[model samples]
Target: MLETYCNASGQRVNNEKSSIFFSKGCPQVTRDGIKNTLQVHDEQLSDRYLGMPTDVGQAKNGTFKYLKDRVWEKIK
Candidate 1:
């Protein structure tokens, strides 16, 4: 699958600036396999992009508290 994409695009993807992210419940062993399969480094998902949660998980309860704290800090 990766071979097909790279071949079709004829472009190289920079792994340093690019990454793959797995959901929280993914087992470490599975994560490792997926990362290796993708041939890119794993990276943390940014909580906020332009002052908003980047994904649904980050926007949900408890997790969003961090962003709220940042907002409160600026308002205060």
Candidate 2:
């Protein structure tokens, strides 16, 4: 699947430096299988991913505050 995506997208994936994200509902067995197949480590959830929230909780405003600030700055 990853290989197909890379082929289609023409983007190379560096497995050593990559991390895969899985939904909370994903089963452990499925996670393990995917990890093994991809030879990539599981993503460790953090406050932000590529400057966006990894997990947006009840506080949507707070979660996206940075984006709002960025837009406001751009407008100014």
lDDT of 2: 0.84
> How far in Å is the alpha carbon of 72 misplaced in model 1?
23
lDDT of candidate 1 over 1-76, digit per residue (tens): 8678889999877777666777889998988887787777656787566777677655387757787888899999
Q: Rate the local accuracy (lDDT) of all candidates.
A: 0.76, 0.84
- Residues 1-76 of candidate 2 have per-residue lDDT tens digits of 8789989999999987778888899999999998998888756666666778888979999878889999999999
User: Candidate 2, after superposition: displacement of residue 55 in Å?
Assistant: 1.2
Count: clashes, candidate 1 = 0
Q: What is the TM-score of each candidate against the true structure?
A: 0.54, 0.65
The top-ranked prediction according to TM-score is 2
**Backbone collisions counted per model:** 0, 0
